[model samples]
Target chain A: MEFDMTKPVPETQPWSEKFWEGTKQGKLLIQVCKDCKSKIFYPRKFCPECWSGNLDWIEASGKAKIFTFSTAYDMVEPKFTDELPYTIAYVDLEEGIRMMTRIIECKPEDIRIDMEVEVVFQERGGYFLPYFRPVGKK
Target chain B: MSKGKIAIIGIGEVPTRNMPERTHWDIIYDTCMEAIKDSGLHKNDIEGAISVTPQAQPKIAAELSFGKLPEELGLKGCKDAVSVNAGGASTSNAIRLAEQWITSGIAKAVLVHHVTVHSTIPIPDLINFFARAGVDLQWEYPYGTTYNIIMGLMANRYMHESDCKPEEMASVVTALRSWAAKDTNSFFYGKEVPSVEKVLASALLNTPLHKRESNVLGDGGSAMVIVSAEDAKKMKRPAAYKLGDSVRYFSGTCVMRDFYKVAEGFVVTAKEAMAQAGITKEDVSLWNCYLAYPLAHPLIAELLEVAPQGMGGKYFLEGRMSFGGDIPWSSIGDAPGRGHTGSGVSTACYVETARQLMGKAGERQVKNCKYVYQNAGGGSGFNNIATIWGKEI
Candidate 1:
């Protein structure tokens, strides 16, 4: 899809800059809270579990399971109408973090709950958006 | 048992409509005049004014935010004024805050009102406005996060976790619409009440959700006069006494982060409200839970223990939520069919339920509606508040 100024894009926060930087390189990074031994995603400044600020980033395996999904057949934001019949899904990564992303390169009928999938990146307005699809597909 | 310290003595509602000719001030004037007239109290009797922030206006909207309504209506001696937003839950918030002002000796009577002017907003932009209400601007909206998409995703997951099928939910729309069609005040009153088959066949707005399966938005408003229990007896109209209520907001971006907690939120409010009222589930003769998205009604039914788990959809299918059903949203039609007035439909539900309890619901009255259970909040996430009401304090 071509870049459109009307469409929404992320305004990367200071804490989330590393995540965006990693996405630009086509790598999926999960933030780990060292104090609570927990993993975080979307980049929190403090650990949600233990409220600890000690954190680190780990590259993920890119594998996930479909937690749930739905396809927009109609009535989306006007700016997104050009890309009709697209799927939005929340996928659970191997690290056990549920992230909201889209499922691409698969028919709506083929997407099912608990379906195996992996992360792939697409360039949108100079930023890589992580989307998932059925595993083992090009 | 929790005491009934407060009661709603008066109500006014302007039927949901496109209403292009009416201005925002006209709606506020009409609703408040009807309610204040019904209240049997003059401007001096009103001590405070509360309103929900409206969504449809120009650069500056809901100008009544700073107790402007009391001033505009010449509410003499009106010392307290404030505006609040909690989405549909804002309706309940207005009433709850009124109770506070009255209890603290700050106000003898409080006027709580909500109004939205959709006529001014372009028709196409209406969906865009409602969709953005529940989404995170940075994280979610850019990825085409429309309200329908969010509701559909929640419904999609609700079906997956509860074994509710798309076909079963069709009956919910049909049953709820029947109630809406019965009331002239409802947006769907003259509109067709689609059959279960038609609902399932309606054009898909989002996967697993049909266009007919959700709610309709319109321009309208509802207002009420709430007073201390002592003053309720002086009113000509029968007051709907507050038996018990539980209100709270779990503020956050998305509930999907911990989806399981959604069930906990539903159960907590319902149980707390019922417990405070010193009543069991069997005591309520009517239910006025908000008709938010497709997922809200059934998900609430099951988790609140009103129905067995995974049986929320079946509960509606059995006609249990219809006019003669066990617990009904049909009496005066709810938000789904009645017309969602943005953040005020739940407020509208307050007016409708008070009407039912006061024996003023005419043709839409529920039999033996002595005690009613009602809920309203951010339908998709953020908050849900539950309350129980009675005919007598």
Candidate 2:
């Protein structure tokens, strides 16, 4: 499927450029605090745990477990109308960070809490967005 | 240091249903006028004014073109007049700010007002506005996460962790509808109360949240006149004094916090407010909880210590929160039945509580109401504000 340019695109900030660039190269990245050794998601410039500005990036293992999820059947933005019954979820990755992502390649009913999955990328709005799918599927 | 000296002497609200003809400022002006008239005080008695709306624009520019509330309302003695935007917690926070002003002698009497015109916006724009208001644009918004989806994710996790069945959650909807049926001002007033089965069977807005579980948006306005305790005794109407008040801000983004502890902020703020009031959980005669969604009703009840953790839904299931029940929570239909009117829902809670304390709530009044606990939060428990109102000092 082609990317939907009409959808909102991530505005990469000075701090988040590295993470977005990693996604473009088909890699999932998370931030690690150099001072406190804490793991972070959504790529913050400073460590929220210790307020430390010393941060580094690491490639994720691409493994995850569904923490929770919800499937939208209605009330979505008009641009997202074509992708009805879409599931948005929070997944606990092997890197010790919980990320908000979309779950694909499985029926909504089949999705369960703590279900193991792995990361996959799909281009959207000119960015390769990382999504999760049930392990051993597609 | 003591906020107990301030009291709410009067409260007013416009009919909280669809009113397409009324402008945003019209509702704000009329609500403030009604509240002032109800207080048995002239407009000149107002010394300060605070306005709360959901819009991101400044208060003066958003509410009226000519001037702020002090000038528009003709308060020549007004010492302070400003606007506040705290999402659903704005009104309660506004009251807290007004209390500080009165106790500090910055103003002898203060007027707090809130109005919303959510119904005037088109569906697509409304959806977009709500989406931006709740989601993190740089990360979550691009992924198509809307407000309902955020609440849906929270509900799913909460139900899984607590083993809360859908029927138990549906019981909250059933109870709220039952309460709304009694209030003539509610949007769902005189409507049939949906059964638990019907609620569960309703169209699923998102997984684990049925259509009826979400609030119905409407246009409405609410205002309150608060003054010092000394001034309150001189008024013709009975007063609801502020026993305690607290506001806490954690994280604006929902994903940054632990989803399991989503209601933790409510617990902290409520505990502080109750401690300040020198009361325990049992001293609360009525609970005017801000029920923006069905899931929140149970979650907030647990956090406020009215019901034990994991038992909030059970309280609703057993009918313990209905009018005349043991807990007497949400006696005036709250946001779900009254229709969520942006930040005005918070002020509406205070309005209903004041009426109950003054023995003015017609049919749904809590008998011998002495102390009322009001709680409101914004941005999925990002900022929690709690207030305790008492009939006696």
Which model scores highest in DockQ?
A: 2
Q: On a 0 to 100 scale, what is the lDDT of residue A40 in model 1? A: 79
Q: Interface RMSDs of all predictions?
A: 4.7, 4.9
For residues B121-201, write the lDDT of model 1, one tens digit per residue: 775566556666677765666677676777777788888888887767887887777788778788888678777789988
Chain B: TM-scores of all predictions: 0.93, 0.93
Clashes in each model (backbone N, CA, C under 3 Å)? 1, 0
Tens digits of per-residue lDDT for model 1, A32-115: 988888987668889888989999999999999988888998877667888889988878899988877889999998999899
**Model 1: CA > 4 A from native:** A1-5, B58-62, B123-128, B234-237, B248-251, B255-257
* lDDT tens per residue, model 2, B346-365: 77888888888887788888
Per model, the share of native interface contacts recovered reads: 0.58, 0.69
Off by over 4 Å in 2: A1-5, B1-3, B56-61, B64-66, B234-236
